[model samples]
Target: MNKYLMTIKNKQYIRFFLIPTILCLILAISVVFVLLNQRKGELVDLENRSQLQTSLLSEKIAGKLNSLELVLSMINQSARSMDLDNETDRERLISLVKSQLYLQDDLEGLCILSPDGSKIYSSFHIITENLLENQQRMITTHTRQDISFSLFSFIDNKAWHLVLSRSLFDQSGDLVAIVGLLIETHSFFDLLSVTEIPGLERAILFDTAGKTIATWNQKDALGKETIHLEENIHLIPSFSDSNILNTQDQTINAGIKTVRFENSLLTTVKLGNFPLSLGMETFIDKAMASYDNALVISMSVLFLFIIISLTVITLLGKQVIEQEQVQQVMMDELSEKVKSRTAELEKLSTLDSLTGLINRRKINSLLAEQIDNRSKEPTFCCIMIIDIDHFKLVNDNFGHQTGDEVLIHIVRVLQQSLGPLGTLSRWGGDELLVLLPSHSAQQALDIAKDLLVHIRDNPFSPDIMSTISIGIAQYREGELSSDLISRADTALYEAKGSGRNRVILG
Candidate 1:
């Protein structure tokens, strides 16, 4: 009977241990399954986030490219009438290029190469020998594109380059010069230097041929040949499927799948109208291991440490959540500040500091855009060039501070006179440009007369009497903005030659 009792006690103990073991096994399986699903969900969320970020970065890059294109166009137009052989013209060209380079800090170098590859002018203080060799090779292999972008590396420096170039054309459409700007790779990286999500292992940008152009902190990979393609063969299927959906207006749903070699997730976005794409990768195994480790610790402390572990985890999680919330708020505030500063800078760039009127460079850009639109629609546009008569005399009599006050007062009066019918911009010292869209030459002339009468009647200062010389030129079909402005300037000279306060129409 005692032996039977011993056997029964042993069986009961075995049964007790077996039940708990089975329960533990079931719980482990459930946890593993839940963790796997959670990891999958995290990967999906990461892909979505990456896709949005890539799209935003691509749009930013595209905007920069557009700005570059506009710059090239301006340089081309400004240089078209300029005889570079003349010392004054060459100096003016150099000044223009230097000003542009100053405005765009990303431009490491700005140079105008002659057709024979001779360096005519350069913004950088580099040895011209290297520039000459590179440009000569470029010219030799050049296709007749008006504007082009190319990626290259320097033999002297590890810095990669994105060169934006435009062929300067003469009045007869003859290619005269090759104007180009070199942008450092770091400028491209700035677009990606933002908040990064966890699980994101890599963020890369590549050219159309799958060559790595830029990557986050991946300096060594730059200018490498088709590294992205070799590393991301599995992404080809996804890219192919989503290529049709990617557009400037649309945010594409770039679905995530496993990477080629590693246990990873990948997504990509193509920059609009550019032969470049942005890509992101996330490692699944590494991202999941931390959660698994925590789970194991929790399971190991089933009874004795459960209460302590739960309390610690709860407090830590709360703290982490609070910290994350604070970080998110701070990030949002920083982003807003950056955006505000950028907008302010952009606005300041386009406006004259003294008079609060549009600057000459901005006016040129506006006129160019208007001309392009008018060329398509065949609309009547008028450019009026106005100069302050005896302005230097005012500065000579009064202080420059007083002269500044006079300029500001004049701009305000012009703004009031023009109202919404025209745009008033400062052309240079004591000169202003009035753009009248969809207006005839006679209408512009009438407006100019009114302006002259108003200025002459209401003086900026009682002691210093001021009048304006007016030059009016109506836009002709297929004429460039520079050409129109030039004609108006000729008329301005005529007005000044005839009389200070007179109006001349060209």
Candidate 2:
């Protein structure tokens, strides 16, 4: 009878303890499998988003390059018209070059290199020797008929600038001079900031040789210093593979690619037809934070289920089923919330927070779209820039709250006046841009005059009356959006210079 009791006890232990333990192990493995799959999905989503970001960045870079090339082409035409040998004509050419720098804020300086590679005229009083040498090298090796890009350092390597050079030819088809446009590397930093990603660790623009041209590191705070790497050092070590860095391989250079590192992920893309590449790095741990939290919760739930199974096996089985159902519901809810929040963020990104008007970035996209459409089918379009005269005084004499009220008041007046005419956007502080598609210059001018009257008539406060200055420009055929805006901006400057509360046409 004692032996039979012992046998029964062993059988009970095997059924209750050993079987449940084995089941717990299997459950843990299943949970891990689900979490791993979830983590993989997250990575795929990240890559898709990163690719979109890189493509947007490339477009911006290409737009900037196009603008620069346009400026160079304009300068070349102007220079070709003037006689460089004559002192008076040469002075006029110099003035023209200086005016270009003033019109385009991105241009560091403009210089005309003689056939012998010596600087004939420069906007700067002193042209550095290294800059001249770099331009000379570009001109010597450049065989392309279009604009050529090269990187050069100046001021004892304290400053780096991207040089855009275009060769000028006389009517005889002989090389006359090379017009060079210098752009500071920091200008490219704005591109990175405008398209900043949440988990971005570093954003870099590199030449074909893997030399860093411009870089933005997450460690640097606002207005801190920008990092500049040495000429020989490669800022991004992961791109050391010859195949990856090969510019001639159109297959690799066609689109953005994801490169996984030990601790991070890299998204790299080549600037279209340019010898430069852009790379954005994001931290893997930060990106997987949600996955990590979910894993922890799952493991805790599994442990709790194991404890319950030891106590009450049947109850534990029911609890496991119920918990899984609850988890699935929670996950569904989480996904919905994420999708809703993402949509909201995208909408908010395109509008101004204060005035609820379309923001500068959104307006730019609209203008670009109009330009594209115009290329396919010709049409008239005009852009107007409006500035609040003495806007700073409102904030100085009154408080910021009152200033806010004034801006809102102005936006309301403009909206009422601009019903169904065009799209109005808040270009920047105390400034706004109006896009009038299918409107001629005179029509835009008339609209600007009407807007001036409306603002003058409606006062934000009895004590505070706001006035505006308007600049109008009609888009020309084959003109760039930046050039059109620049013309309008120049007209605005003229309007402000002559008198506030007036209209000027560019």
Candidate 3:
């Protein structure tokens, strides 16, 4: 009877343990298989999305280029009918170009170049030599039947401009002149901005040689200035080789491809019939975030099932709950510390350490904001650049400590005199920049005069005398922040040059 009881006990134990073990193994395998299929589907969806976006963007670019080409052809026809040497003909051409520029906001300027690349007529006065060289190269490389595209810029700034050139031929079929259209890259940037989709981190436009022409980041699109091509040339992917771009078959060149680069999955599509390609990139983690979360949940469920099957569910669950609670507490503490540190850092970054005033970078951002607002709604705004006259002499005669004290004292006097009229920033050593919004040139001038008087009265020390020169500039319609600041700085130099301790309006 005892032997029979032992056998029954052993059979019950196997029934309780072995059956559930087998079932759990089967369930885990099924879960993994389903997850694999799901992951594959997700990847395919991502690929399809990327391909569709790339094709749409390519078509948009091609459409814009076609429109530009039509305009260039119209201009070429007009050029062929006139004689560029005659003064009346030149005036007529200029008038036509100016009218076109006024009509098309995307057109930056227009120019007619001789066969040798000398400018015969230009709508704008400032032309870079690089434009001439590019035109000349186009004239030399392509036949009269071909229309060419190249990049150029103005002499004053580093902004990139795209040029579409078509050659003009006389009845003899010899190249007579080249008609070029200058295109604003900002329009292209705007297009990119409009077409941006979720999960897209960056979109870059590059030429056949892998030189970046333009780049747009989703995060920086609104606040930051457009990136200079020369500065971001190295950002082009290394896999963008001639083998990919120089394929003999045209269909292959039109096809889009996906490749991996660093931590990103890059989708690249060549622009239609142009020596340019657009690349859209997204980080791998961002692209797979949903899939990763689903996988983790599925794995955790399988783990819980296994634990329950082992008959230690209640104790293990309680332990897990305790561990999770502890983890949450630790995370909360860490988050609080990080928030405190970040706040401290942000404050330190924007303010000057010594005088507790706004720093140059913060002031520049504020000025830009004001300029943008002015563009939207016309307003009166002025900026003043104040320089402590003969400051270097103070450091030389007295000590650096006394010079610092003088700077601090002057800041206090200016703050007291201005009295909420303007924002004061420490531009650099012994130099301050004040932004006065809703103030006209005359109001700004009066404020500057008051500041000068206050500085003259306030001495750094009993023995040390300090004075400041003020230069003021009012914002003009459609003017940039840098240009406004430049005028103020110029006025400041003039005030110092004429005589110290004076106010000048720019």
Candidate 4:
């Protein structure tokens, strides 16, 4: 209720009459504002969800590629484990891969051929039927240092596989037989079942050359664009794509915008990296369905509340003065109390009683929030944990007052060195946590070292040259807030461990 109504202490019945109407207005405004805010929030949430899913699919594709590489690695390991190049070890080497993953039958052949392309060891067992066609292809495609891959099609059998061949070298780098690993593409597709997000409905993977390799389709998909077509997002027209291979993996999620044949409606495209640029594209209709009932209920409730208010206001015209006045006064008092309490809580939460620097809790909260929010343009950031070396000994020898003054002096120097762009916090009894937002770890260390030098350089009131040790660390993307602090802590311990008056970074 507004303040004007409260000053009118008379009109008891009138006060009662106006109260309901004022409450109804407050409620109506609040509902509208909340609904609008929620709708905005919903849009941001959807975008994040879609992008995150796309990134995940990309990671899945990269993972499959890695798996292929691992299979090749295993084959190479087989040749080395048995010394395949030595004629005496030929039988054992031939049986190596066959025993692994229980694939003696699935593995068509294993042979050790000489550099001149003549058979040295043959597990295929056909005496007269020479391997000229495949052998010549392999020899031409690979040298002693070269690796090759080929798709093998069996006309009389029902199996799908591609073979990767790697030449083995000795410790002195001598040419050995080409090791082969048969990869079942079906198994790679089967591994795609691990993720559980819906409308993650479908994904198509493209090789580095943009050739379609595989896809995972939802049960309801039309399955045409998803069918082994060329791996071009432009060619498909239903999905959008993204890349995620730098050092680590990432995912992207997009929705099927439109079946251009159906309509050219804009679609959501999720793209990611694992080894391929895979994406999930779906119609916006799924999102619409999720929002439908909540939106309708919200509007319906708003309308119903407005009608009820109107009916009550008609029945009791001006009988709402006292109620409105009382509520208005209470709200003002509550608001003031809340404002004062918030400040008190902030002080209690952040400030150290002795040093007046931020406390551990506030420093930790700031560090976590900053890491999460400041990934893209981490202009500069560093952490420093400072401990008064032999602080307990100082308290025992001199006094707790002198120890407290040392802590205060430490913070004072930090404030002078760091200025406003940095933060200082009391981490524990004799330690201060410092954060320099626009500085590197080295920069922070320089500042810390300078402080130590100043302490040693300047003699205090009673001619004491007090000292402090510091730990420092820089930040990296996706790294937890703990990473820097842990490094700093270790560094601080090192500063103490190796002898005091130095800055160390783990």
Judged by TM-score, which candidate is best?
2
lDDT of 3 by residue, 84-178 (tens): 66789777777877777787778877777777667777776665677666556656644442534343333225566677766766545656677
Which residue runs of candidate 1 sit more than 4 Å off their true CA positions? 1-15, 80-91, 128-133, 143-156, 199-202, 219-234, 237-266, 281-293, 302-506
Candidate 1 TM-score versus the reference: 0.48
Q: In candidate 1, what are the lDDT values of residues 227-281, reduced to their tens digit? A: 3464454455434322211123233234332343356555666665555566665
Model 4 segments more than 4 A misplaced: 1-323, 457-460
lDDT of 4 by residue, 119-163 (tens): 665555443223445455555545632534332221112333434
Which candidate number has the best lDDT?
2
lDDT of 4: 0.59
Overall lDDT per candidate, in order of appearance: 0.70, 0.76, 0.74, 0.59
User: For each candidate, what TM-score against the reference?
Assistant: 0.48, 0.53, 0.50, 0.37
Which residue window of length 10 is worst by lDDT in model 1? 240-249
RMSD of each: 54.9, 54.3, 49.8, 44.1
Better of 3 and 4 by lDDT: 3
The parts of candidate 2 lying over 4 Å away from their true place are 125-133, 139-159, 218-252, 311-506
Weakest lDDT window of 10 consecutive positions for candidate 4: 258-267
Per-prediction tally of clashes: 0, 0, 0, 39
What ranking of all candidate models by lDDT puts the best one first? Answer: 2, 3, 1, 4
- What does the lDDT read for residue 294 in candidate 1? 69
